[model samples]
Target: MFWKTILIVFSIFLSILLYRAYVVFTPDKTIFESCLSSTANHSLKFDQNRLRTFQKLLQFQTISYEVNKQNFDEIKKCRNFIKEHYHDLVTNYSEFVDLYDIAEYSLLYSIQGKNLNLKPFLFSAHMDVVPARDLNRWKYPPFDAHTDKDFIYARGTLDDKGNLFAMMEALKEYLHAYGQPSRTFYVALTHNEEAGHSGAMGIAHHLSQQPFGHNGQFEFVLDEGTTILEEVFPTLNNPIAIIGVAEKGYMSIKYRIAMASGHSSMPSAPTAIGILARAVDKLESTLQPSQFGRGPELSLLHGVTPYLKFPLRLVMSNIWLFGPVIEWVLSRKPGTDALQRTSTAVTLISGGEKENILPTSASATVNLFNDFSNELEKSLSTAARKEPLDTTNYLACQCIVTEFIKIIRYTWLSKKDSSLEQSVFFSLNGYSTLNKMIELTVTRDKPVLASER
Candidate 1:
């Protein structure tokens, strides 16, 4: 009788284990898939021909071309092309196109919905791209539209043009079918996003003065930060869309070390170049804060926790346990780990001029990324105090100052609330949609540090 009772208990336990396994392994439905299907059902067409329009847009050399005067003319042509093709739609939805300006070098178009009473929505994409470094390295001309079975080849195809053109095409189709959207939609195509967003900032400033203020007042904004990839993780079966909620603060610092100039034959204990090199080494060796914060990093951790396996899932589900582990993991890897932490890189170095002369001055430019909690001043102060340098001989100079600017934009996904637990669950649902499409496992990785590249 005792053996029979033991057998019954073992059988029940096995059944429960099998049920748990089944539940864990089952594929979950995501809101994005539902939204996509619903849009498709409503005859929301994603025309290949429209995607071709994006390819055509990419064919132009829209590089900022700072020194080239003709770039302004090219920008005009691109603007004209966009206006000509979408003129009818623009005319029908006159209220949507808020023409901000027609400057000599750039044009600004803001798409506002008919419903003025509703809150405003904005989506920004740059019309300019970075110059192609080497034409010889590319299979096709950087500006030439080339296509493979799965990818489109062009300079700005991935960096941003794809995102901008896709967004424009999507909006055009949506308007063609359903007319103007319910909420106000603003699309600003600036000419100088690559070059400190001079044009974008101008538009942003203009918009700021208007009724639509910055922050949560504008609903949300969306821009290209990362792309969706497929088959990235074992647990995830779909592609994940990485939406950047917030961007890291950027700043540039210059370090100058002075040494007596003399003949090459006579060398001092601390040369300018030598001192600068040591400072560069010191800065690179020391890292900034690795702790995760609000916006995308937090959003990402919450988004992927649901799909994590076993012990990891349990730990990730709880903030107290997951926080330290995520911090530690990000600190170790140079790539994905960079997303969560503030990073620094020495971009430019200058010292001696001639082979025979000892240099009198050496300078190095260091770019840094900081979180919202840390401002540019604080970051600089900390680096100056903490970083090991020859302060006696070295005179630190501030070349470029840092400023915090908040971009007003929103993603298709909703924002998270204060509740840590609920926010994680919501982000997980959003991430699942992206994972399904990209087919990559989204992990609690740091954002790519642009300066590092």
Candidate 2:
């Protein structure tokens, strides 16, 4: 009788749990519609005339090419166009001048503000647009800046030109209204961010030498990065602007194995390609350990705590209560969980070309992001040691040859203050106009990761 009673109660509990899961996961159409309406009401008021000007800018074919000779004319035209339009703005400010010459196909422009004693504010954006791949795939011509009801469609619409034009518009408006800011604002438009920022480096080098301010430096710098998502968190009623506080450091390591080249009919016990493939498989299967202790991700979770449901809200608010749960969730997909931890991936592989002939050489490339606080050497060592590198079970005739791997590391450091976090939050809130419409009912569940992505 007791077992029967327990079973009935257990069934009721399971049904309730299932219902709650359904409630949590199901899409709320009303909320989505409301969000859409909100977005429409607060969308940027882009001027049609200004958009036409931008369209002309887009049509200029300022596509950056790797080889200077290939894109010479396009680059020259873009340079001249920028110089002519910005002449007035440049002439008004005394600090700006022609810094360097573009070798064949490149352009770099600089603008300085009126504050002599203050440190300069550098705002950079590239002029060149990526070449439209598979032109037939585009709804309209890639260069055609088409505007229907809302968006401006072009090759560079989101990648950068939209940002470039937005910055220019902001500057024009700022100059018209405020004359010049308390600090010097330097506007740098480079020709090749897509290619590799060779032009950007030239500009950066030039600015580094200049007497930008009283204390030898720039007060602040802003760059385009991750965008704001309105419903990333269920608890937050407003959009969350993710200002990339720190970007992941990257390192590439190459692994190579060699064996005797021979005919397929008389193959060695293990071929070079087989050995390398096995090593790669082993390395991939045994990934570096994940440590999700703390960082911007935790900060992000805390920032969105207000929007979470009852138990989740309570748990996320107090890390001690839900640390294990958070770790479990993050561990599921290391790539998605990478925001909170270091990640590794075996990205590329190269081996035998001819099917019949046994090739002697094979190689694999491993890419990884290490913890910020850890030293590069230590991280590299840790990665090397932890990753599987066994060569035991090879063919009898195959001589396993292993090459010493090279590790190349790159870091991006920021000098901005933490207050920028608040600024980002405020900017997103302003953009969303959520503060103004706080009283409006949000009837749907928050946007999921798939939707946000």
Candidate 3:
């Protein structure tokens, strides 16, 4: 009787709609997002001191977010603390300058090298971090920078502050002892990378005029990126560190719908909530096809083929033969599947203010990472339902009001070079290992997306 009751309840959605045919074929039923790309070579020395400093840096309440953006006071406090602690390095080791006049938001520190013939190297990290809320859920106060014998937890612990402080401390040590190396060092710490990057905007404007800032040749730019997963892929024994040598393009679209408001007891033909829900579900369900056979992800997969287990390795080695099957398998997990296609994320939805009354209007926001070869306009046109399609297969193949969110250039995970292309993977050894460790075990599954050239 209980089994029957459970079946009856489950039948509501099962009868209404079920997953597409593709998901059923993906076996192993384990999480695939934890998988990554790496070689046996990645190595960075572990240090308890670095972890301690990260905890101290995390203690600073440098919370930055989009809405209710300004937290200038806390930002200044963090900046001042950095200056005070690293006074010797700031005053003697290099040229320390503020990129923004407003509470020292964006910052740049430069250490000139002995040999100008070798190109300079750039290291970048954001000083600001996303706000940590829901205090009750946190193991420790989000800004308290709690540290156990092994783990360090805080607001910016993983998002960025840990990165910023570690670099600064390493820079101070390097400059204090060895002075300068062959490649020049440009350390850039922006004020609010978490919120909108006004600090970065200011720094860019500053770099535009200077001869070395933007014009000078650099060995390679180092930014946040991919990690090394030990064995998420049942096939690999060695950890895989996916270093991004390039990045993807991005765009955002907003949709809104309007309808007559009414009480729950009396419903209308098509309510605002119903219209918006249908449109979003349709937009996502009918997404673009996977591009692993040709995309950058294929390049990384090809590189990792030598490390995969026997049968899987054989399959991965010849993607030309097994491309569709592999896509079907990986595409079930958004984290890996999205890497090969123009990914879409329906982030925000807003509608009714009250439970009893049906709202008159509703809106949804979608963020998309468009493949480099595809145009946003074309992708939009393809995704748009209005231009004659099989109406029976999808949600109302019609849309209402739409808006575009104008965005500044933001850096994310970079692109991996294909077998045919030249790569900058070995350029910055220090950061390569540091980044590997960060994403491998420390940062978990989060990796920032980036643009190459």
Candidate 4:
């Protein structure tokens, strides 16, 4: 009887495994059906003057040095440069568009829509670039916007100015093609995103004071975050854009130890430095518990699992059973490891003065990027249950993932050559992929919000 029971249990287990492998792991073509399709406007060719304007915009030294000490002159020049280059937007469309200088350097363009009932969208980009500290490491001058046969080499070419320029150009193009949009939208360009978000906060404060800010009534807000990643997944052949649903929050813990000082010749059993060192070592050795299959990364993995090859697809699809194995593998690499759990980094440590004397005090600071997905989930669920109409609570969590595409200067590729299979990634002829989003959405007869995608 016992032998018969064991056989039956084993047979059931085998059946379950087979069912999961074949049924659960099967590809679902409909998964990304809601994602935005590349529209015809993506093929629009940018003129030489527009490319020149992009290159000139990159030449500005609007570097954020410190919170109080920023290169304001360069920022002002950049703002003026934008206005001068897009003369049509400022002069021709002055009635529909209103420009405001928030926190002195930040620029906010409020474009009025024909329909007042539609909730406006907000798009944000930062103007200032981090200082180019290691000039010797750069192949070209950091601010030069050097154009080779393929790429434009500059500090802000990829980060934010690229997005900013693309947005402005898209707006101008929309006006020329479709005229004033049916849905209202706002573009906010902050001057000090790298150093501090004061400019952003100023704009936020200004918007909050307006009538639309009452219930967070906007359609959606798109801000700068992660870029498009190529070869992010090992088994997947295609590049995936990471719309960051949310960013990891961080906390810092500072440890300080104080002990009696003595000569090096006669040391105590545990000195202050020794105690601190051991504590730091323990913290380093013990990692935070992995939160795999719990966060937005789970959503990401599920979305991409069908595209991944063979065993990986099977493994990702059956995360409930293979989570520990996948977690172990993911934890091996720093970049991939961060996606699995909260990460710890000992950024600062200091202790002694002279070699002869024993240190009296020692301190260490450990920074942790917390996996706050649980908290976020709860907040989202609560907001949805309590107030379905008020989407302000949901705005912070929605994000876009896109690859940092190559920006080809002065050269435009044909539609056939520019396909993803050719691996061109995208070009700046129309406004690259990031900016093309704005162009496609507003220009379409029916506006498609990023959240819907």
Candidate 5:
């Protein structure tokens, strides 16, 4: 009877989750056809000339790694190509286009408008393309810009260069056809967007150097984003355009774990690598608090609600009543979970140098895209663990360390052998500098981000 009761409860729980998943979102009218009515409906004629320029742009090897500029010649070649192609733009419209080259790599084209009455807008595009690692893996050469009929295959084709050129192509045609725009515009084509945001920072500094309210505040800024997705919603046959309402907050945390080092041949049980593995595993397993229902997820669901069919429509329409249930369902998915919680990713790790030697120290980098549930400060504070939220996973790693440290004690010729004695060493090391930095940033800027519910 007890087993039967447990089984029934489990079955009920499973049913509830399914029910919530099905009743996920509220229906709203599709905004696709409706948006064409606005000024955004302006005709953009991207001819063969534009397309060829785009392909040529892709051929330039504008690559960077972690703030370090790489392939300077190729990058300069690409910039020169832009200058040559947009000669009319640079020469005739020189004063208007303010072709200021900041950082020698970034292009900050500030187009001063005729009407000072209107607030200016900014167009952000990155010139840098990521390196194509292992040339053999690619179908055609990554830089070749191979084309047939349907698509142009290249490295920066999808991510950024395509968007950047599209903006330029549109502007080139628009400026040529219809002189100066009523409202001012700033075109920021950053050279270091792929690695360092130095280019963007340079542009900001340039703007600050200008007179107060130089271009006034912006009307609205547009960036490369979700173009359209037909299959995004469960029952929607319609294409959905995702307008980013908000951006997620970003933070990187570095942690170091230390243990006794010795020869690998001697084979210490709780070696540096072994202890680190346990700790990293625990960090991965211990998840953050989820905010699915009361977050931006509801807004996303609402956008697609109108297209949902049958009982699915009924479920979504009534999300208000079953929000927690929906949250539970959404939390099951990694993509959806990211929308709801402060995400954790162990990006970097370094432990040992040689195969034969056991290292004394291990370090890891944890990058988090923090949600703006309360604000940046509170969200990060909540994520920081004073108490282990996942006691089981936390204790499991500690237990593994405790047990293995015994075997290591014999090999290392250590003073303390008992688990309690060695537990102090197994404990985490706090870096004061990093702590102060994070605290200062959070307090000053309150850099927070989250999906709106």
Candidate 6:
């Protein structure tokens, strides 16, 4: 009887494995099939003069070191360059475009479209870039704007300037090509986004006073995003661009403990440092609640499952059966882990000054990036449901939803271990590549992208 039971168990295990393998190897129609096909070739023209102008912008040292500490002259010069270059919108089209200066340096352009019925949207990018520490480590001067056969290397190339310049150029091209758009939109260029969002806050306040700025009036707000990554999936052979839909919330907490001070020779049972160390360790070991399936990541996984190769596709599609295994694998890496749960990192620790003395008090600073996407999603859904959408708005809404999922999907999948090649490529080539890509994508998918929904 025991031998017969063993044989039966082995047979069942083999059957299950075979079934899983079959499921993994087979292909089926996916909802994301439409997005996979290549669309019409729509390209943006970027002449050498445009590249030179971008290089000139990079030459400016608009660095933000701290609150009230910035290269004001450089900032002014950069703004002047923008105003001079975009004279068509700033001066010539004054009747249609309204430009406002917020927080002295920040810029806001409110463009009135022909259509008044459509909801408006906003696009934002910062003007200031963080100061380059350890300048000696740079291949070229931080503000030199060195260009080769394939790249333009500079300090603020990737941070904000690339996006900002690309956006401005795209807008200029659109206005010149097709005239005023049907939907209204706003462009906000914050002066101090790196040090803080003070400029952005001021702009927000100014907008809030306007009638259209009432809460939840704008259709969407597009801001800075992750890079277009190559070889995101081990099996998938394509590059992907990730848009940041929502920003991660964060907080830094200082953990402290007080105990009797003593000499090292006669230390107490539990020293303050020891206690603090254990607390820090416990915080790192005990992770926040997993929001894997409950968040947008699940939708992301579902969308990309069809594109994934072989066993990975099967495993992702059958998440119900392999959730714990997948979670365990993801939790092993810090980058991937952040997508599933809040991350805790003990950044700084303080204790004894002298080696021979036991510290009376010990403290550690823990920085945590909160994972509240599940709650945020629910709230957003509720808010969206409160206002009924017309067909145009609904399609627009669907496009936004599809794009959001694609963003998260690419971000999640690409959150793998970075290679030296990736680091070097991103350092030099990423910014310029991203600029052209965004210009092309925004122009190409202006309306057709809605159909992908």
Alpha-carbon runs more than 4 Å astray in model 6: 1-43, 256-275, 350-363, 374-453
Q: Candidate 4: where is the Cα deviation over 4 Å?
A: 1-48, 252-275, 350-363, 374-453
lDDT of 4 by residue, 1-453 (tens): 999999999999767765676777677767557768455554346567777888999999999886668898999999888767777776788878888887888888888899978988878787888899879999999999988878889989877899899888888877876778898988888888766555755676666666666454567666665777888877887778888655665334454555566899997755667656666675677666678878888888887887887677767777888889988998999998899776767788899878999887777766666564533223223322322111231112222101101121112233433132111111111112111111000011222344764
| Candidate 5 lDDT for residue 131 | 81
Taking the tens digit of each residue's C-alpha lDDT, what string does model 1 give over 1-453? 999999999999656554444453343556446433345424435467776777778877777754343365666777777767766666777765655553344445566666778877666666778889978899888887788787778889876777778777777777777776777766766665555334543555555555654333566656655778765444556678777775565555565555557888987655667766887887888776555754367667667656657655555556544577767776776766667666788888888989989887777777776664555555665676544353443332221112111211222224432222222222212221111100101111222233433
Q: Candidate 6 on 206-288: residue-level lDDT in tens?
A: 66666665433667667777787777566876566665555454444454555556799997655667656665665666666
List candidate 2 segments past 4 Å from native. Answer: 1-44, 60-73, 92-115, 129-137, 212-215, 307-309, 333-335, 386-453
**Per-residue lDDT of model 3, residues 286-350, tens digit only:** 77756676667777776666556656765666565678888898888878777777777788888
Q: Estimate each model's TM-score.
A: 0.74, 0.68, 0.72, 0.72, 0.74, 0.70
lDDT of 5 at 77: 85
Q: Could you give candidate 2's per-residue lDDT for residues 310-369 as a string of tens digits?
A: 566655666654677887776676544776555667888787869899876777777767
lDDT of 5 by residue, 1-453 (tens): 999999999999767755654545423335444554434545565568767888999999888765565777888888878767877887887767768887787776778888877777777777787788998888898888998778888999976888889888778867876778887887777776656545655666565455424334456556655567677657778777778655565555555545555787887665655655665675688787776666676788866665678666656666766667777777788877788887877788787878888776666666767664634444444444422112222222343333323332232114433322122111100110111112111011111222211
Between the candidate structures 4 and 5, which one is better when assessed by lDDT?
4
**RMSD of candidates 1 onward, in order:** 11.5, 14.2, 15.3, 17.1, 14.0, 17.5
What does the lDDT read for residue 140 in candidate 1? 86
Q: Which residues of candidate 1, in runs, are more than 4 Å off? A: 1-33, 36-48, 65-70, 95-98, 110-114, 213-216, 230-234, 293-296, 392-453
**Comparison by lDDT, 1 against 2, better one:** 1
Answer with 3 or 4, whichever has the higher TM-score.
4
lDDT leader: 4
Q: Candidate 4: what lDDT?
A: 0.66
After the best TM-score superposition of candidate 4, give how far the Cα of residue 224 lies from its true spot, in angstroms.
1.9
Q: For residue 10, give model 1's deviation from the true position in Å.
A: 22
> Rank order by lDDT, top first?
4, 6, 5, 1, 3, 2
